[model samples]
Each structure stands twice: as structure tokens, then as C-alpha cells.
Target: MAMQGTLLEFILGWLMIPWRIFVEIYRHAFPPANEAGEHEHEGMLDASSGDITIDKRELSHWTKLSQQWWDPEGDFALLHGFNHCRIPMILDAYSKYIAQKPLPDTNPLRGAKIIDVGCGAGFVSEPLREYGADITGVDMVPAVIELAKAHWNERHPTEIGPDYLCTSVEEISSQRPEEFDMVLCLEVLDHVANWKEFAAQSCRLLRPGGCAIFSTINRTLAALIIAIIGGEHLLRIVPMDTHHLRKFIKPSEVEYELNKHGLVQVNLTGCTPVDPWARRPRWSDVSYCGVTYAITAVKRA
Candidate 1:
């Protein structure tokens, strides 16, 4: 059995050599540009000018999947299962760092205002709302926002739920600067054209001392194989082209951007699937972050 396992490992390692070479060539051919020059040549720069983070390609891809946003057994099942771990991380961070008080057993987040950036069909927003949070779910995709609203309405016929908006985080920050207790940008950092600008705007939306939570896949060869090749191609978990290689940001890069915007890192945790087939993620150590990770930061007072 040991010999067989070793042979399998050797075979896999040999198979990955070609992918490693391709990654190197891709990186060298299209070297990451500085923040000022990033995506300028690709015609990806949004005309809206100041801190516009929307990527048209990404928008179109998500728009096509808007109808499947709430399907637990469909394309986004991995994301739906992600809520189990991310929700607790959000609550723990808020209670420990932002709230600084022991929360009540019921409605722990009662009266807490949260902005769910890139909130697709209210997946994260709906759960947080159930915990008594006042959530505003913002997404650039119109169809998903509508779906979110319809789903919320169906779920709560007598009571209102999260405020679903069809807009960008930059627009929201401009209108309601420093108003929220928490800003969540889960699975969104890699999708934006300009992550620095997106991080800045996300931080701007938070009130002083408020928490900002972000989750994204790391830029590494492991991520390339698992997230893009395996998940998108072999397993067909997420839609094709849902992620791009060049857009994935490293954890250190995220911390640097958030720190520049006056947000201090409080916690960083890695998340990965429980198994290849199940695809359900669980919180793990930072060492496992070569694939996917979540970070919590607090804006300075």
C-alpha cells in the first residue's frame, strides 16, 4: 500500500510539471503590473474612473449564472456550503473585536449594520439576517439582486429582510461612507479588476473601528489546478471562467492593501474542502491558504 501511494504521488507530481511550466510562462508573458498600470492594456479599465472595480468579463460570466445563484445542488453548491464556516467567522470577529461585548444568545447581531458586497442572491446576507443583522446586499448583477429580493420576500412575507441593491461597492461607499458596522467581500476580491481600489472602497464603507471581512483564493499553482482546472473543468462545480489566474491575490497582498486603507489584520484563516468529492469547506490553518483563505481586518478609529 505504501509503495502504491508513493507511485501515485510520483505520477501526480510528474503530471503537474507541464502545468508548472505553463504557469511560469504565463506569468512572465503577462507580468503583474503595478496598481497604476494594471489592466490598462487589456481595455479592462472601467470608464467610471475613481476606484471602479467591476470587471466586464466577470460581470458577464456572473450574469449568465444569476439564475443558478440559489441552486444548492447546482453550480454554486460549494459556495452555499461555505456559509457554514464563513458565517461563524464573521460573528466571532464582530463579537470579539468590534462589539467588544458578549453578545446575547438570541439575535446576537441585532442592530448591527452589515454591507454584503458582491452578495449573490443573498446567500450570505440571508443567513446573517437570520441572526438579527441589518444587512444590505449589493451586487452588480441585476438579476441576482432581483432573485435575492424575491427569495427574501418569499421567506419573510410578514417581515422585511436584507436590503438588496443592484450597484457597486464604490457607489455604495460614496453614498453611505462610514456607515456600516461590518463590510463583507467574500469570494469577490479575485473577481474585481482592481483589488486595491476594491479593498479601499470596502474599508471606506465601514465606520471607524468597524470590521471588514474578505475571502478569496490565493494565487498559486495549487490554486490553479484545484480551483480552475479541477473545480471548473473536471468536477464542473463552478461555471467556466468564473475565475482568472492573473486576478487571484496572495494573502500578503491583501493585508498590504487593507493596511494602507487603515485596516489592521485581526485574523487570517485558511479554508478548504473536507474532501474532493464532497466539496464542502471547513476552517483550517493558515498554512492551508495556498488554495483559499479568509481574513478579518478592523478599521482604525
Candidate 2:
């Protein structure tokens, strides 16, 4: 009976797939374009002015898997609202990183030239534009880029909507050098094999004294059990094997890499996502020792 029920559910889910795709496509496509007078073609900057180009791609299989309804681990329902339960965590970290500045606003990132490297659907970059920044968000997958652009254009249109790019880091770096004031590399290092190369290209994109922010889970027993096993296996919050211990980096290693490239660590903070099961955030959940961390570094003046 259980096996029969499972098959029935699968057939029902398959029937719903096309409707979901159509709804998703409609939501992504029509968000009401800005007034024609307000429309500014972002990528075509004159040589006299600094121009920033962007590259974007689709979300990874892990991300796509996480977006489906059947994937109870998926946050597609929550994330589409741009109010993922993690927003508060990200906002709190951004607040402290700026040192007493208002959360997400009143920061130098606003209206500044910014690059979101490995930006997986503009979770950080979209809100960063709330401060008026000329933002560009990039990723490795065109699908995720399309989703990010769709969200930005339709749902979260800011005073300055961010530019979306579908390309690799090397491609963007080769095209636009020393162009951004802030480069964001959030929650991406653990997924990247050539982290050192990614770091170098991030620093290269920033101007002198510019800042870059990066966040990722550290490799540790606690992380494996909590972030991977508990989150991925037990609760099904994040996609399985989406995080690998080998790719995680310690704070010291990150500092060393930045110093090697003339980028100095300016600030560091820890982040812990609120457990969906937990009704509210707790201090016990907060710790600097965990796998999740955020760091801000500046290019040497």
C-alpha cells in the first residue's frame, strides 16, 4: 500500500510540473518594466566613464532541485518571496560589518559600483541595491541568472536595478579590470574548486581601497554534522552533497590568500541560519566557531 501511494503521488507531481513551469515563467517575465524615460541600458558605458559588465548563468542542479515543490528541502517557496528565513541573518551580519551603520542602508555599498561574484540568484546583490548601488550580479548558471534577472526586473525593482551577466569570472575580469568598489563573493567558495583563482580575480576587479565580502561554511566536524548531515540529510533544508568539506576554508587561510594578493582583512563576523524548526533565533545558535562566516577585506590603498 505504501509503495502504491508513493507511485500515485509521483504521477500527481508529474502532472503538476507543467503548470508550475508556466506559473514560474509568467512570474519571471512580467514585472512591469520601468517607464521608458527611466530605462537606462546599463552595460553600454562610454570609455570616459567606468563601465562594469556582468556575466550570469543558470542555477546549479542542486539549486534547481531545491526549487521544486516536491523537494521539501527546497526553499523555493520562501526564497521567491526574497524573504528567505536567512534574510535576517544576512542583514545582521551586514549591519555589524559596517560598524554601527544602519542595516543594509547607510553603507558605502549604496550607489557604489558593485560586483556580486558567484551571486546565486541575487539574494545579497538585490538588497544591496536598496542602498542605491549600481549593482551587477553574476553566477555560473544561466537558469539561475534568468531567475535572478526575472526577480530583479519584476519583483524587486530598485532605484538602480542591477545588471545581470552570464559568464565566468575569468571572462568578466578579462573584459573589465579594476572597475568595482565592492565585490561580493558570498556563500560560493565551498562550491568552487579553484578558490585561489576566484579570489585573485575578485581582488583584481576592485579599485584601490575597495572592499570585497565573502561568506562560506568552514570545514569541520560541527559543520559536517550540522550543515551537511543535519541540514541536508535529516531536515532536508539544503540539497545533499551541495557542500563538501574539501572546499571549505578556514579564516586564516582566507586571510593568507588575501594578504598574498594585497587585499587586507578589515573585518570578520560569523553567521548562523535560523533553523526552520526553531520559532525564533537564539543566542545558543550564534557562534564564531561554526562553518558559516562573513569576512570583509579591502584592497591596499
Candidate 3:
């Protein structure tokens, strides 16, 4: 068994697929930009209300797995199990600020508005809604958004869930600038070519004093060894090509990029693949290292 695992890891590690092909495919899906650099086409992929970034292979890839998104131990299990750490990290970040009313039992985040950027099948958005947040989830993939919307409504028809959109953060932020209390880009930064633009969009979407939280992989030798060779190849926790080495950003990189976009880092913490305390063995972090982490940044007033 050990030899098999090692062999599998060795074979898969060599599968370092290039990301540019995916980018070119997406570009072909839309019209060429004119001299002004504006997208000549806007409605492709059902993102009529928004424009798309250059790299969007992740969207097209994940859209195929929409049916398994909500399954706890399925293809998206890493994200499913991550709720334990993610919810706590987000709540802890918000708890520091002073507010007029006391936290409500039913919805601690009542009256607050949150935008879940790159929300896959409404995983983060639906749960946040129970906390009384007026949530809006945006993703570049129209098919995934439709699937997520249908699933959310069918499961929680009575509950106030997120308003899911088939759009990019860039488009939505432009439409309603400086309008959210919090913006979350969980497990998404590494998948897009427009990370810097995404950071800028977060700043535009946030109200004065509003915050943005991002969870993504760190660029390190250890990360490539463990996350790629071990997780994707050997253990098969996530899909192959789920992570792109070129897209991984360092921790300081995120701080610096967001800072340049007028957002200040409040807190950052490392995360493991699953929560350790869960009865089932899952992903969780032992300490704040330079691995995978969650970062909270507040937009300046």
C-alpha cells in the first residue's frame, strides 16, 4: 500500500499541467477587446450583468462537478469540512469591532451584508445567511451558479439564502461599489489570473470599515510536495489540477497586494485541510505556518 501510494504520487507529480491553455480557451469564448480594452462581449457564460477575467479554467472545471458540491464527503469535501475553521475565523474577525446592538441568538450578523466571491454552489453563502447576513454569492460560471441556486432553494426554501449570480467580482463591484459589510474570497484566489484585480475589486465592493477574507494556498516547496503530490495524487482529497503552482501566492504577497488596493490586514492564520476535532478525520491546521491560511483585511475609510 505504501509503495502504491508513493508510485501514484510520483506519476501524478509529473502531471504539472500548464494553465495558459485554459486561459486561451476562455478568451475564445468571448469577443476580442478593442483599443479601449473593454470586453467587446459581455453576456457569454450567462454573466450578462458582469465581465469575466482572463483566466477562468477553474470555473469551467468546477461547473462539471456542481452536482457533487453539496455532498459532505464527495469531490468538494475539503471545502465542506473547512466550514469548522472558516466560520470561526470570520466570526472572530467581526467580533472585535464595536456595534450598536447585541449579537442576536438566531443571527449574530443580522443587518450586515456579505458578498461571497467565487462562491461554489453557495457553500459559504448559505451558512452565513443563517447568521442574518444579507448575502450575495458571485461566481464566473453560469452553470454552477444555476445549480447552486437550485440546490439552495430546494434544501432551504423557507430560509433566507444567498442571491447567487453568474458573474465575476469585477463586474458586480463596478455595478455596486462600496456596498458590502464583508467580502469573502475563500479558496478562490489561487484559481484566477486576476488576483490583483480581484483584490482591487474587493476594495471597491467594501464599505468604509468593511472587511474581506481570503483563504488560499501558500507558494512553498512544502505546499507543492504535500498539497499537490500527496493530497491530489496519493490521497485524492481534491481534483487533479485543482491547484496551479503559478497561481499560488505567498502570505506577504496577499498583505502587500491588498494593502496596495486600500485594504489593511487585520489578522492571518494557517489552516489544515480538515478540522481535527471532527469525529471523522478531516482537514485542520496545527499552527500558523506558511501553508494554507485565512486572511482578513479591512478596507480603509
User: TM-score winner among the candidates?
Assistant: 1
Tell me the TM-score of model 3: 0.80
Poorest 10 consecutive residues of model 3 by lDDT?
35-44
Tens digit per residue, CA lDDT, model 3, 126-239 = 888878778999987777788888887898888667889887777788899988888898988877655776777867898888888988988776776666665666566666
- Candidate 1 at 175: error in angstroms? 1.0
Top-lDDT structure, candidate number? 1
RMSD of every prediction: 5.4, 13.1, 6.3
Task: TM-score each candidate.
Answer: 0.86, 0.67, 0.80
- Candidate 3 regions off by >4 Å? 1-54, 98-102, 273-286
lDDT of 2 by residue, 1-301 (tens): 0011245545654465455445434433452232111113332222233222221111345455523522222343323322342344444444454333664435534546878898767766777676566888877666777777777777755444778897777678778878987778877776554566677878888877777777777766677666655544444445444555545678788888988888888767676545445422222224475667767787787
Which lDDT tens digits does candidate 1 get at residues 1-301? 0011245545664566567557644864676554346545343554446545777777788888888777766677778878777888888888998789888889999999999999989989998999999999999889889999999889888887999999888888999999999999999988887788888888999999899899998888788887876665555566655766777889999999999989999888888655446644443334478889998999999
lDDT of each: 0.80, 0.59, 0.71
A best-first ranking of the candidates according to their TM-score comes to 1, 3, 2
lDDT of 1 at 235: 55
Choose 2 or 3, whichever is better by lDDT.
Answer: 3
Off by over 4 Å in 1: 1-36, 39-45, 48-51, 279-287
State the lDDT at 63 in candidate 3.
Answer: 71
